[model samples]
Target: MKDSFDDPPPVPPSERASLPDGLRFAFGTLTVLPARITRWDRPAARTGMACAPVAGLAVGLLAAVPGVLLLLLGGGPLLAAAVTVAVPAALTRGLHLDGLADTADGLGSAKPADAALRIMKQSDIGPFGVIALLIVLLVQTAALADVYADSWVRGALATVAAAVAGRLAMTLASREGVPAARPEGLGAAVAGVVPSRAAVAVTALVTAAAALAALPLGLPTALQYAASVLAALAAAEMLLRRCVRRFGGVTGDVFGALCEVAGTTALVLLALG
Candidate 1:
């Protein structure tokens, strides 16, 4: 599928020019590969918002590719889980993870939003960030370790679904009143146009399908997985609303945090089941 995250080859000049002005601008970021798809322009913002669900779907599929490859390699469950982590690292070049680390350092310091956001922008990671990253990674590693050991394919699917659903939460956060931390930052553009209800429905539907799909293949309890996704979404919504009230809206850092939180929630629920 020609999804947004595939990073397709550049469109021909004639085709690019022929697109409606809105689409040209909406997809302009594709030409730049990993560049921010959203800009301050209204057309781009709305279009970018509309495209986020597709982005989630594409990214999820891409992340799953590695896990399947590992399974084919006869790798054990732990190795298969590791491949799941590696896939996102390669696809995003660790950008979201960096956001996770930075946000941890900044938020853990208990500073005001402006000051904390400034800290996050610093090149160096602080002790808090490092510790937080370690804990989050450890949780993921452990959860996948168990899942893969039991059912490699189920573990792989869970990982992919979590990645997709988590980002949807982050994207939904951007739909509210939050302004980007930086005037020209990537998060600013995309965050502003987030479609809250649409994001919720899309994520829920995808996650539900993932849960059901896994059932025929010995995945975790379907009810538990469904509940986990719902809980994660609820938690993210509450957190995003708080952030909006406190700091004005979701930033890239918050988005990263949302991903981590949602992913962890899914894993925890799966474990309990």
Candidate 2:
């Protein structure tokens, strides 16, 4: 065996400027960018899911800028919503949509837990996935129409908040000390490095920020928005816990499911507001 001193000293944070292309590729593909930095440091449970909220925040900001600009420029509500939705889709390369589809397929399946997992691993989409995606798009579009028509600034804030919070919930779901059904996958890798405390801290911080920003919508509206996001997060955590119990852990498809469910739940809550 080589001596311990033979290895080079650990890389300092200041010198960690350019990451390996594979690191960026892994992170970009997952759409969990913040977790990318964490992956480099301790590459286990926290990496995959953690980066998601950070990426979602960045993507949300990118989408919000255009929506705000279009609204300021006198563009119609539909145009603004279109821009908001399109930009996020482009950023994550429609990965969430695939998750939405897979989740639908799995949930709609009457098969056993293992069978549902098997179906999720398939690359092809089923009728359930198709129907679910269409309905999700319809509901989100309608909600955006209402939100934008009411107040463009509020609409932008809510959109950004939902994106960030949804991913935050997914990260939280990953911390239950369970292994995914599969032997090797990004989801399993992420679950390994994620510290339970970090998940709580991040979720709390984002929740506080989102509630504060929703104030412009009015105290009642802000409370409603906060309640809605929390409800979604709670539901997701319950579902993830159940899935872990049933299947023994969360997979890439499960992570996707969590994100889609969380996002949809948040949007529906905004609509309720």
Per-residue lDDT of model 2, residues 80-173, tens digit only = 8877877776776677778768767876787787898788778999999999888877776677767887788777877887777667776786
Measured by lDDT, the strongest candidate is 2
- Evaluated at residue 121, the lDDT of candidate 2 is 76
List ranges where model 1 is wrong by over 4 Å: 1-40, 179-182, 215-220
The sequence of per-residue lDDT tens digits that candidate 1 reaches over residues 125-223 is 999878877887778777876776666666766676676567657656656344666665666766655344545555667667766866775544776
Model 1: residue 119 alpha-carbon error in angstroms: 0.7
Error of 1 at 10 (Å): 32
Lowest-scoring 10 consecutive residues by lDDT in candidate 2?
1-10
